[model samples]
Target: MKFPLRLKFFVFASLLAVAPLVLVAQNLTRLTRDELRSAANEELTTVATQLRTEFDSTFRGRWLTPLMVIRNAIDSDALGVSQKISLLTLGLEELPQVVALQLSVQGSDLPILVTNESFSKRLVQNGLDPIETLTTSDDLISAIEGTGQFGRPLIAQISETGDWLATLALPLTSTIAGRQVTMAAKIDLSVLGQLVKRHPFAQRGEITVIDHAGRRVLGEQVELLTTRSIVSSALPLIVAGARADALEPYTRPDGSAMLGAYAFPDWFPWAVITELSEASAYAVSNAITRQILVVGLVGFAIASLGAMIFARQLTQPILSIGQVAERVRHGDFTARVENIRTGDEIADLARRFNQMIAQLGQRLELMKFVSEGTISAIRKADQDGISRGGERSSVSVIFTDIRGYTEFSERVAPEVVIEALNCYFEVQTGIVNRHHGDIDKFIGDALVAVFEGPDKEQRAVTCGVEITEAMTSLLEEYPEYNLHVGIGVASGEVVKGAIGARNRMDFTVLGSTVNLSARLCSKAAPEQVLVDQATMKAGQSKADLQFNQLAPIMLKGYSDPVQTYSALRHIQP
Candidate 1:
């Protein structure tokens, strides 16, 4: 259910390739089946019409010959009653379909002249008394008279043996004798059975002729004739007088599925239905469906194979990039994707990833040159600090200047001055760091720094004293250099930040605190440390430190004289 991208792409491509072929096969099968059904219906309808035409012509020809023979005998003056009987007998013998011929006075209950002695025998065999049934049968008399009145042939009742016979009666007018008589003939209808039997409607098909009462008149099945009603079954469309050709499905008596095509003949009160097994009718369509299925399966297989190869080619570079990215995630910046020459988006992405890795390597190198304190300040600036602009904070500022630094630089070589400066800075930096002070910057021969947090003033004073002791030790090691340091400590509020132009900036402290510290450094003598009153009071708790209050002096840029203190040495207990 949860297929990967490659498999999903392959399946979709296969379907896209095979869909049109499947559609074409389906449409072709449907159209062919429709055509076959139409052709079958037309063939059955034509056969029904032809059978009806033949039945009409054959039965009418048989009926008219007997009628002419009776008329000729009645009109012949030379023929007596006995002679007329003989002539009618010859006519009846020649037309085997004519079962009986009779002559009766118009209103008489008895027929005066009757041919065919077998007629009475046939009636007796069918459980009828020849004397009473023939002479007193009201239905028989009514049929004969009604035919004469209507001037057309009429079908009589079926015998007990299920045979159809017709009676035709005509009025014989004897103008010379001034009397009217009727002549009637009985004809057999067994020819309809033979007609239906001779015609086969379809392959594996059965042809049936049903009469007006839904009874089967003629078909291959003898049990259906005059016994079974088609209306009682599912085929209600198979009825008499139906004018259009139609096909429908139903189950046969044996419980087999069948399709029937039916039509009503123009000349008979019966419907001709041709039935074929449903499986046989659609056998060709089933074959076509199987063929289409095979073709569709083959097409899909071919499409899937091609899609697999194509998808692999498309995703190979992306997979390589992913592996390289994983390596980089674990701090392996040296790993990179290589040998991708497709020149598409994948190639472009590989190039961008490599460029990012190279940039990371350069940034790591740059981090080594930056001091930890400066780095922390930059990180703090990124989180809302001096990086945006500047801020005011309470901090203790310390400044140290090498006494006679200008004279030392003038006399010594440039390399010697730089070497001496580096040595001095190494000793001072260690002291400041031990006291938890951040060196703001070194300006030529001067060191400027700020200390914050609790007891920053005491830490600054301790750092200043340690810096002087370290410088004294350093001077003894390098006797060629005459270097001595002076330190100043001030505690107050100062504005601290990164300031300057966009291209150049410095993180430093400004305001009166930094100014006061610089002024104290200027006032100190060689190897001495000076502090303002605020720094002295902040360090008073340190009992071992000795501080001497200096004379109040007027400092530049201030109208009032500022009080100061000189830290001499630690007191011996």
Candidate 2:
């Protein structure tokens, strides 16, 4: 079946990586070889696009707009000349695309300013002469008569590396006169060279730029054609377009077999070509070819045995994973893949399988402790304890709330708020766990937890008091968070354990106890622990605890005002 070039490439690459030497057993496939070469050329064209984007983004889009605006704002022709020159020079340094920018006036042969100060000074000392270094086959005076933007490629030879540079010249004004200005910008080849140097394929790959005249403008070691034209070489292929173009692998003058040609951007006449070695491109396949030869040398009589050994070596990890998966299906969570070490996808699957089994084991252990029915209830409820059909039970409720949570969260990033919440939960949960409290759920910036459930009896008030005191001490120790909490405690007979229908269940407390505790928590101010009269009487406190009566406040769904009190300590003056 026919496939898109990219998809076909991925399939070819996968096969090459697996059985590289298998190609040697059969006749050389021209179609497969052409596909590989096409893929390589496509990759080089992609890189060229990346280069163009980088250049445009760095100069034309981001850094040049301000300079152009300044140029347009020029009122007087006299002072604007020097200012424009300086602006152009500044543009070169600020932009990565512009290697150099020089403004040459129509009246004088000398460039008014060159962006590189060192180069400018050198030109002055040597008597500025464009003819000596940069020769215009056609005079510049005639070229600047255009009304709009006019640009062309020039073969530029610079001081740095003798690399060919892409030079662009644009008329500073709409019309040419006795005195007009022109701006010239150059793209540094050193930047492209650096990219090639850092690239993984540079040693086996080549990037070449051929100009409009079919001359070798800028590239690595590519010999220019003395007789035949680059125009003749590229014109017919250019019509075929972005991915339809083809390259014939040819032997270079240096006797190296190199894949030729790549893509050219429509914006410019220049063609970018990449040449890579067949040996290096298909190195893995060549290695497999050698392995097949070795197998053949060992003798055909034992070929089946050798093939079995090879197949086993490749799939041992997969087999081990299959065994582990079977064990997990039978509830053996500890089963693990054995003696499998490969970086391929099989190894990845095996690792994920092992992790899955481990998670299953942990869940099974949780199931054992919480009872089968409770485990089923919790799983069906999700993380939030929202379920139907609430019942009544004797449950002790506690609420720890954060003061100024809204303002605090707003002041920081979302991630920072989450991180702080995690740290706060760790400390709060540790205190609850120590007091044998079963955490119900978090409600915004507050936590709702319960004491004396299932096994515990008659110690709800003591546990509740201990949790509050412990949390208060923790807040004082960690002043970095600037945290404070209001805790409330209440005890009463209500629906405990898992509440809701058989299909849906929540491990939470309901009835008046939960409602009273929540109301008391809301009444407490920052850094205060407020308890309802029920909880206070149940605690049987011995420590010197002071309480101040707060005004009666009406609550939601309650007809009468509830009497509230704030826990406080008096300081003797």
Candidate 3:
């Protein structure tokens, strides 16, 4: 406490007199809080579990069967485009919640969209057209792109009515009339409100759906809930969705308390949360402890003023440092404790900590510009620092490039082109990381990734297959973007090293394996993955895909044609 001798003595005497009574009051408060918390947990668990089951039954199983059948019928070449439309119309009847169905082809600006008769009339009443307005609407565009859902159950909200809708697009493996075809359906999510209304717990508490971000996806709040208060306090527990107990009671601004519990569905990103508003019943416990605390307050009144002064002076700077550290931990490196003026060892510690943080921030910022593989190499380098030298190491290299980006970019706006590229990279990067590969570099629309260790070839081939499939899905789901990818994988020896000017250096791998991969990528068709003989042999056991032998690939550097194998993008069964 840094207390002077006389002040310490005075404070000690005062605390000694009040200690017994303060202990009694604290014990009562603890006991009361625990009892109330336990009861709330048991009740909340039962409610949350029941709601979770109801949600699974209502939402998860409603779409797939009919959608899959419709998808298959569209793929059948026996059906003409009008016949396909007729089948889709019938499928719409089969799934009443699905309000609209749309069929679009790659590289086309217009699409065929069909809606239920009532919704079509509603569109007309709103001065809209099923073909023109809904086709060009932002929400429909987001749904086609599957913005939040990745590929299925694509969700977007109608701004005009504040209603949510989801889309599920089924793409044809065989192109119709030389153009790739996709069938999409818009599902009304107001069904969520209907589902929740059936729950009898409404009079006791509120039960609703929320996203991972704590936004009310669907609840009593019409459309998306803009209010941040109702369940935001319990959002972390809601997202975790692993606990079976209720939240500790939290008080609202009006002083009424709430108990909360949440459960997640296995098939969806949303969670179900139930909250009950209740009166706090701790008044009896407080009343019983009131007299004891009153006696203690008098005995400690003389020391309270000095204690508060000491705590404020001593702990405020420490608290600021702690807060900044917390922000730093969460990636806000800009936060700093700049107000410390203690002028003691604590102040010195704060100064050094800020300097250390600044240096770390600079290093981390630089790290993003380089490949993760390069970073790994640097980390494993000798402590004395890397020399301008290289070592031979075996690695599997996978190279990918966007197949028709030049034409796509020429036709699309520059910003739109960038957004499209980012989408492709995001999908490819996650696939690479999951397969234990590290990105080597991104050269314009081309990406190079490296995988090491015993299973490098298998990992590289699997990563390439995933990238092809992911890109295929992204393009097929939103064929409006009209882009595709070609990937190639090769496994061989390469020179790995840090080499450049003394002032600037880069860690990279260089060999025929890298060149071979690039050449195969250039020769690959859109949505195709080509692998060298070594990589293909090494990856024969990869269950996600199997290699199909390709014709010999002749390139500039090699006298003999290089043998290659391929894996096509996943075809939905």
Candidate 4:
């Protein structure tokens, strides 16, 4: 079994390699999802903000400003009624978006009016003043009160022209002859339609302007303005009393899911919203996630394939060694490896295997006492060329001992005690092996194990706790044995390698850290696990494990008392 340790390592190494790829792939998928959401919010918000800005600039300059100038001039005493008609006629002709302009005096029923050529001539033939009629609505009262304000745009159709138009009323700044005169402009809906149409998303996705009441002011497919069942759910927040931005999930009238964002001009009551379906918005990131997962899985599959091949290649020699050892186990000391050659670690391993077999043959009595982990450690050294002369390295040492074993043995039969010990040993060894720990040796009722590598401290602490719990369960099963186990774990610099006379060497770890662990184990109560300051500080539990601080204890070989932490349970023992 000189190469058995390395063979097992091949399997563990495979898991180690693939675990990170799996974790990274999962993390990448999550990160991509979040990043895509953020980008969607930014893109839609930008589009909405740009449209709002365009409306602000266009309304202030081209449409609203011109009508205000005409309002101020006619309200003055310098301009007579005849001169005002000519000026209004020319002003209406100059602004194409303005379908008509009405200058209304608060006390006068006959108000001055001018109409664009686009306006249906039927309004005049039918004795209807289109400007006065539409402007008479209560929605324009604030604009008509000489506040110089812009009223909310209203969407309507002219019966005669059958054309959709949005109206905006721009009020006069001054009162003339003790009467309020307001200039109202009837603008074509195409004015705002063109603003929305210029955006790219308006083609692939929906883009439109919606007032506070969820009325569609400028986009196609307008729903009737109603109080109940508002069209855009985002309308409430987006068109709140104070204008603010909104980037939210929206559902279309057809119940399709959409990601939408809206923006409003400073004084405007309408919200310009840009929208795209969720599927379309995250399409690119989803593609990237699929590619990442595919590449990661493919890479993991290739890595797994290599691990199997390596495990097989390494297994062949270990199997040969196993067969020979199996014979040796049956008291046939003459067994030897016959057909293992690779001119690599396996070739060197073959020589070591033969040497171990010869040594086992020479000292059958001594070999019987060696623990399996001690044997594995020797083989690991032989396979890797690690010196028997030990080196100093950071390691976590674990010590576990059954309490009251002597008294229990005194009451029980010799065979019973041996069988009980064997059962406990089997369970304990499995626990240690699974945690990547190697048993150094067994001293009567006590077992010592060592763990190394980056996470050795945490693994050692957890192993100690599990061993304590397992002992508790085992005690219940073997109630007659009447025993409990106490365990200790400590991490620090240690000398790790084979030690003792060459003829009877044992692979072991030795240092003050080992002594501390042994002493802590002795101090532990039955069914408890104890760990040194180093283990407690460096060991972070992956499980929902809690630790309680223990008073410092003065143990043998230490002048100062050592700090400790109890890990067996949530409460200190």
Candidate 5:
């Protein structure tokens, strides 16, 4: 009851092949996912650093200095109408970022100097001359008449003007009143808009500054803007009349979620708020995820392919040994293994299988002589034998070949010919790889590859068309070679696996589908791609291309000819 030695080896090889594929698949999946998250986090951290630096510099350099100058002018004994006016004007002109700078006297009817005639006229037009009304506002008078600057930068609402402004009320000690007077410098709301507008995410997000009184000091009050009284929310969060960064998640008018960071500037108790949309701020993460999925699919495919190869290598030898073992069990000692694979377990298996077969052949007279039986047995027993393991996913495939390689190769020297072929393949290969395509195999001057595989779930037809277009541009880079390529594409469930005898295995595809596609390649004109109906159907919406139906033609092995189409041009990616 001895089994053939070849059969026993084949079974052993099958077991070896199957075990590794499962392990390889698991490792590949874990590594790919982890790398995806790491890359995304790094990008986000870089963006945050940039935002922080930009905000710090913009506030200190542009808004703070002029405020101090206006405060000093009002407190000086030497300050007269002319000197105060000169100081305010100088400060305003020097700091273009400042919208208003002024000095007010204690219990006096007017500010000594107000920069910008337009603002002065606005006050005059409002029925209170800038020079006359400064004295009547009891709050202004009270603030100024103090021993020192009465109040710090108070982000308060000025009912006189409905617009929001950051006001710094610095008190000045007046010798005349035996008390301090207040000098106020205010910044307009438009400044925040200008600053936030510079962000790449600004269109998707916004920034807002709110004052101690729960009034917006900078940034527009969009419809979704909300306020929790500063006395209620911020007072407890800060030191006694000091600064702090208070953050919270808020939603904008358009329903986008935002992250707000608040900072209180000293000159004005106005809270400077920087807000970024949750989606917009973390968009790079999503992009990274997409990139990872693409790259992962590729790695997984490569791994899966490698696993299958390993499986076949492992299975073939064992299967061969098994057959020999079965034969020995039947007492056929002379059933010798032929062409036993060299160098490894499979080689060892081949040797053992040969030994058993030799014993069987010597002991029994019922064995059939097979050519390369032992080598074939070991390979069959090798676990890394050809096997199918893949999930059905939408993917892109591109096939390309030289249009005139037959004529071109004849003219070039064999060395030069090989060099040119390698050069052409190398350049084109790099291009396809960059675009994330998996190299299938090459046939002389032709290439076949897939995209959006275990790595990318790309639209195969669209990618095929894109590669076609891209290749045209790429071929131009190698000016020395007047090369033109034709491509053909058909995407379906094609069995992809390692196929061949023993150690001389090749990763390739089976099923008439792939062959039919290759045949389409032959029919295509120079620089043209003959895509099958299946590819065109998949790419209907994704590709921007022109197409015309080619007459049904009979393939050599098939009884019925299949319908095909010629893709004239590409439309999109």
Candidate 6:
């Protein structure tokens, strides 16, 4: 069977598109897998470092406590063997990691005392005397003499009856008896194994801890302690002050390929190793590849069928209209359908839609221009009350003026002055909007705004505090420009509307309230927020605000003195 020319072309185009999509899918999956693997390795290294630090700190504390107590006992001749035994018992009770404490004379073959009863019983059961076990070991004797001369603790690693032990030996000098003694504390290595068991690896990964000799100290395998680590070759490098963390591929004991990250912690004689099977690590990439193949096949079949059905109905005019609509959606309002003359309903529909879109675009542009030039609330009110003059409403009026702005502008260039002013205004405008207020206008370096609502007084006060804070931050960014503002707030009735000549008009609030606010602003000090008594009383219910009443003062336009208050506290949003 033969297919139509369009049908053949459709099948070929679908194959072309699906080929690149399938390749991209596979590449993206591979890249994501590599990134995830790297992140996992880094996280494992961090965890290992933290665990090693915690263990070293705990071990040092356990070792040093008994050494200090024994030295104190030797300095006082009043502390005999019985008194020393009491101090050792107290040290053992406090340090959970210390299994036993022993005291012996330097170069002696017997211990003067042993604190742990369990350890004494264990020595007897194993046919070893407690004194001989403490004195006959060459490691213990060497550690004692070395620590006495150098004032450092020595750790001796030993295994007894399938259990690992670390004994810390320190030397104490008797000022009274004029002799040197050894104080030793034994710590159980099984605690490290238990700690490793508590923090398991992710998925099927494994964690291992190895001693300085590259002998496994703790791991998932019970036999690990008896075998040397496979990465023992790296131990010399670590001892020579090389970095502890590395990524390399190796084969596990089970003959499975694996990727591992190893780290040797600082100030500790141990290495942490983390490993994951290579097959498991690549499982996600494999699954993504299979999914991409299946999806490409299904998408190609669907595209071929869809092309066959739509090939005949798709015309030039329809394509042109679709293109125009897409451009309009992306904010290209100038786009229009061209050469759409089919003499059918589709052609007429395209013409009418184009006209509608053009008209909408013009209206939106005009609205945006007006909104940017004036306060949004006043613009809305002007549209609603264009026919009428204005409306009378009870509102709170706020006025803020930059102090010393005139002198500052005279000192700087025009561009610098404009830039600094614009930045300051931008911050203040946002503050007004957030407090449910509308900016009336900016006159020189001054701003006029109005707030209308049940909470108008509180909103205006909060706006003043925020504006002061915003200006302080702005001055920090532009340190060359020294700028500050003073704010005044008053509450009363006002006529709000667009006022001025027909060609050029401004939306503003006009009343005695506006005059009082402006006058108070002129009288305010730098960074001060002054409010009329009425506004302070209205916002008195706000618990977070602080107000102090000022003496009544006469204004330029008022016959009676106006009672006012200063907003003393600044609250953060």
Candidate 6: clashing pairs of residues:
none
Least accurate 10 contiguous residues by lDDT in model 6: 220-229
Q: Could you give candidate 6's per-residue lDDT for residues 1-573 as a string of tens digits? A: 967556665867687769788779968887977976776666666666666765666555555555566556654666777777778877777766666777656556556555456765676787766555544254556754655532333334433434455666665665224546666666656676666667756446777776655666643233333232346655775567565577766775668877776776554566777667766676777788778878888888887777755553445566678788989889888888877766789789899979977987897786544433243544565444444256798999999999879889999999988988888988998999998787777889999888987899999998998898788887788767788999999999998766787657766778999999998898888888899988999987887788888888888899999888888563576
| Candidate 2 lDDT tens digits, 34-117 | 566668766655665554444344445443464455345432455545566666656666765444665656666666444455
Instruction: Please say which candidate is ahead in lDDT: 1 or 3.
Output: 3
For residue 30, give model 6's deviation from the true position in Å.
Answer: 1.8
Instruction: Note the residue pairs that clash in candidate 1.
Output: none
lDDT of 1 at 434: 94
Report lDDT (CA) for all predictions.
0.73, 0.59, 0.75, 0.75, 0.57, 0.72
Better of 4 and 5 by lDDT: 4
Model 1 lDDT tens row, 466-509 = 88888888889986688899988899999876678766766677
Please give, for residues 1-573, the per-residue lDDT of candidate 4 as tens digits. 364655566658667776787687677767876888888888899998998898888877877677777766766667766777787888888887777777777767766767775454556665666655445444355544445445655457655544566566656555667676666677776666777877787766777677777766664555544332323554676546556787778665677777878788754667777777877777876797678778767776776778778778878887787788889889888888887777888778878988998887777666556655466565676555445577797999999999989999999899988998899988999999999987778899899988988789888888888888888899888787889998888889998667777566667778899998999999999978888877887764555456779999988898999898888545435
Model 1, residue 557: displacement in angstroms? Answer: 61
- Candidates sorted by lDDT, best first: 3, 4, 1, 6, 2, 5
Q: List the residue pairs that clash in candidate 3.
A: none
After TM-score superposition, the amount by which residue 34's alpha carbon in candidate 5 deviates from its true location, in angstroms, is 7.3
Q: Which model, 1 or 3, shows the larger TM-score? A: 3
Compute each candidate's TM-score over C-alphas. Answer: 0.42, 0.38, 0.46, 0.43, 0.35, 0.43
In model 3, which range of ten residues has the least summed lDDT? 219-228
The TM-score of candidate 4 is: 0.43
Off by over 4 Å in 2: 1-24, 27-45, 48-70, 73-82, 85-89, 92-111, 120-138, 144-149, 159-161, 174-178, 186-189, 219-222, 225-232, 235-247, 251-257, 300-573
